[model samples]
Target: MPKKRQYQHLKSFKPIAPVSPALSSSSSRGSDSNAPAKGVNELLSGLRRSAAGSSSASSPHLLANGPSVHPDLRSILQIPDTPPPAPRRPVRTRFDASGRRLPAGPPPPRSWVTTRGQDVDLSHRMRGLKLKDAPSDHNALPGAYLPGRGSLIDRVLRAIASDWEFQRAYQQYHLYFLPNHLKPALLRHIGISGGGVTLADLKLILLPPTDLYEQGELEADSHTTNEVSYLDLSRSLGRSIRLRDVTNFLVPPAPQVHDTHLEDSWDAAVDATPSPPRALLPNLTHLSLALSPDDAEGGSWRHLLDFASKTSHITHLSLAYWPDPCLAPRAQTSKVTTPQGNKIYYGGTNFYSHSLDHDWSEALLVLRKLSRCFYELEYLDLTGCGSWFKALMLETEHDHVDWAVHWGKVTDLRLYAGFPRQEDMAAAEQVAFAEVMETAALVERHIRHMRAGKGRFINVERDRPAT
Candidate 1:
């Protein structure tokens, strides 16, 4: 430093200061490193400020100004743009010989094809095969697959015929109320049995008149009245009519006089009707006539008995009568005092021996005639005939000629003992009378059996006397 170092053109330089050893070292190292760091920091701060300003601006404006564009390029870009033509495909010509332009042939059919991989020839297949043309076998044997002859019609016809025949046969043995339309069929097929047909199978028959005197739709005078009109429709029967059928015919006690008189007139009307032809029922085996005790005195019983006697072929007979003790004496005592009275008595008693004062002598004559006519008699039911039946039994003086001996073949007998009112001594007398009649019937049966050379077993049934 003593020797001045010639320095060329060191103009306006600041003077260097003296440094301590520590200070010198520090000045060289620290100041040199700090100078570069300070410059780098200032440069980095300026770059950070510029980057922050640009980031805060709107993105659209920034992008717009980001790239430069020439005016010529802008005008060229603004020109009306036209899109390029679409790619062209090859044109197919119809005149082409190979037919390439025609729509691709239909896709190959999807079918299961057996290939030659199997143990058979595929190329020459069906070469020698021919479909056979043969006639079908259509001729069939009788009653083959075709349905067998149907039996429906045949079965139905048979059923109808069988049912009709059964119905017809059943009607011949029982009385019935039948419809007017069907009566002809019933009559045409009346069975061999002599008795009347049953009430069943004649459901369609007309009901009897409720009021005999009233002129109603079902009156006897009605045009519709016929054979079916006689059926008693007020009752419904189960199987067969029994003894009750006879008893039920009696008129109830109410309006007794009116009903009794009307019934008497009805009986007369029935008797007045002309008899049917003899051949109407050639097999007629039985006949039954029922009368009330009150009607016996009015001379109705005599007429009924006479009618029964005239229709002679009744083999099995049943006569039911209700007795009136009050009138019995009058009938027994009445005699022909004058010519007119003689005629009346004769007509009433039918020319029977009337000298005997008995209630049933006149009626007994008619029964005797019936017995003589029906020689093959098998059964007799003289129920409710009163003391006359007793007298018939008691008058057994003539062994073979008596009434019982006349109908000696009668095996079945039903004697209904009629008892009159028995108040005080009357009841006892009535019982005595019934017992006498019962005894007579038993004795007659016994005598008939003894004559026939057959053992007689008598069965007696007795009940309290009924009016």
Candidate 2:
């Protein structure tokens, strides 16, 4: 055991004040309390003043000669003749990192704190799948993305190693449909040194539906640079373009290019000149359009029709879920009263009456115009088109199309209507004999008219078998 240290003497010890020897000697002769203290104070003030006035390099004899401070007191009250210099901290040198001060070498291994004992880089592990501009396979389209690398055997081995690891590896690659930022780059790539892709030889183009795509921050700059137009497509097609799905892709280009200078005068001239009013797709053969009655009024459909005029050589046409053009009302009319005091005019199919023999005049008129537009049409598919097939078959008063005269080259036609059960049809016919009988008679006549031409194939499908 260690012994405790002693501090007992410190408790009773008395401190002594320094007094001048002369004053002390005089005080010893006749003891006076205040006089000795007053003398010592005077002497101390005189020494301090004299020491401050004298130079630092002066001899030590000046202080000895000046005040008769006793040797014992002098040692005790030893103030330095000159004040010491102010203390300074040492400066650490810093090298400029912007300009390399040291020889180039490999970067030091990342700290344990940074790596956290993980094999994969922290940033790489944290990163999510991002859409890439170019595909891993150069042969694939701009939007195509293949997740895994290597052959089937390699992939299978990887899958066997770890199911989660395989899934994570597969999730790294992503594809976005025709992003706004990528459009300009894709066009340049195709027009310039694009490998395996050529404008002249490019045949099929399948664009994603509007709902499936990511437009991605289409600001003024991006819009100007990346906006793909109908004109651009036409030029890129170069007479070989077919099977184009222009559902959401056909947009008119920006009128003016901002913040750019033209080096080539020919390019400037081309921009200045307006596009000629003619069929945009003169050689387009296979056309597919999915339009609703609401979109029929839009300028997009009109612009498309301008491209696909009578001059267009479209053969195969597919109208998926196309609206009934005849049922669409062109204009809204105000309520009107007849002279007989009965309200007659409002809008739409309400204008026609049951008393008057019903003729599908509006639908037939529209259909006739469309047939004339696509006069070279051979095959037509109207799948999921509501009441359009019925309208096509129904008789009209005027502007009737002779199936032989209009679609001379027609070989195949596919139509889809609801599957009305044979028993239900029979029951409906019995209940509404007059209406069903008339419709049945007209359907028989139209079927005969359509099938009159040899080598023509027409197949109408239902949701399910009517039997």
Candidate 3:
């Protein structure tokens, strides 16, 4: 029985149920008291009433928020209705002098004043040579005929009459003795005879034979020792000839006989007669002497220098000899007096004492004397001389270290065959050659104020490197 009671007590029980909304709503509808509607239609009607109330209450709020819908929209609305116009610049004027303009008037023409302080027609003068008459075959005929059959004597006499014409014609027609073929003809044409002609005139003699003489060929000797066989043709030509041609004959080895006996014989033949009074070539601008090795042995250069001292106007001089030091004796004395009253004294040992110490000094004395006496020298060609000259001229140890200073005015120099062997065609030697060229250029540019073509060393063949 207890088990049965316990089982019935343990059994589950259901709770009381709540009333349904539909039933409540039906009750409310039926009662019609002051309660809200509960059906779908009433609910809809209540929502509509609430919506209408909400709309009425929020109408003012919507209007207040409507104006500020978005920040971008407000900025767009506030933008200016019209844009601003661009600025303008002022215009420039034409006639103002402040602005850059072309020159007002034409420029002055190029001009230069003449030496005579006159406004000469420079352009007209610069204009090329005007043809007096068109150069025709007829115009050249007279010049062509004059060379062969014209009377040269008559022309010379006529030229002598007019000094200006003579000077101009002399400068133009006083031909140099450059052609070998013309030498004998000229010498023959100008007969050798004793006249009032001085050696100065003889210096002007343009005997073509002298050019031949330079080429180691001379006409057969017509003179003998006892009598004057060959005429003094040089004197005759000197009277009428210009001295310019003598420069060519003054080249090295003139009267090129080597034998002293023969030289003496030739000298005697030329001046056989004991003439009372004869003028030496005082205006001799150029002179060359070829001394033999034998002649240089007995201090013969002193005698030669003595003879040279006589020629007061010898401006350019060249002394060349075969490779023989003895040919140019180096002698110095404390007191050396010439027959012409020119006295020289050596303060030191004589140059030709056969001592190496005084070699250069002695050579310098000779060169100094020559340069001092011949101040008008323009060119000095020392091609074949021995080292004695160079030792004196180039050595810097002596007091007269600047041996070539006197020759500063000389414009042209020809040094061939005798340059130091080591200096031949070397880069270092180029400086020495350049120095020489510089000196020449300075003279030509400043002193002479003229341009001239200078010779340069040209290698005949490529120099091969030593193995």
Q: Highest lDDT among the candidates is held by which one?
A: 2
C-alpha lDDT of candidate 1 relative to the true structure: 0.41
lDDT of model 1 at residue 21? 95
Ranking by TM-score: 2, 1, 3
lDDT of 2 by residue, 1-467 (tens): 99999987677556778899999888877765454556888889989888976754364545444546565775788944433344565653344458646445544467953566564665444432211322233222122222344546323423332342333235222212334333333332332222222322222122223343458532322323123221112112222232233321232233553545556676454445555433323334554442332233221333345545533566766564554453334433446688889875464443342224464565566667767778887766564444445566756666655466676566555554322325546764445433433444454357566667553554433233224
Residue 283: error of model 1 in Å? 3.5
Clashing pairs in 1: 173-196, 174-196, 174-197, 174-198, 175-197, 293-322, 383-416, 422-426, 422-427
Q: Across residues 1-467, which tens digit of lDDT does each residue of candidate 1 receive?
A: 49878777778678878778998898889888876555788889999988988885634445454555666786888843233344566664554477566446443344422343342564334322311111111111111121122245323322332355454455333223333433422322221111222333332222342433355644444434232211121111212233233222221112222233344464465433333333322344444433333343322343333444444555555454534212233454455567555424423332244335444443444445555666666555555654454544443223222433556565555554644344565666866676756665565665565555543332322233456
Q: After superposition, how far is residue 405 of candidate 1 from its true place, in Å?
A: 5.7
Clash totals, every prediction: 9, 0, 5
> Candidate 3: lDDT over CA atoms?
0.39
lDDT for each of the candidates?
A: 0.41, 0.44, 0.39
| Winner of 2 and 3 under TM-score | 2
Q: State the TM-score for model 3.
A: 0.27
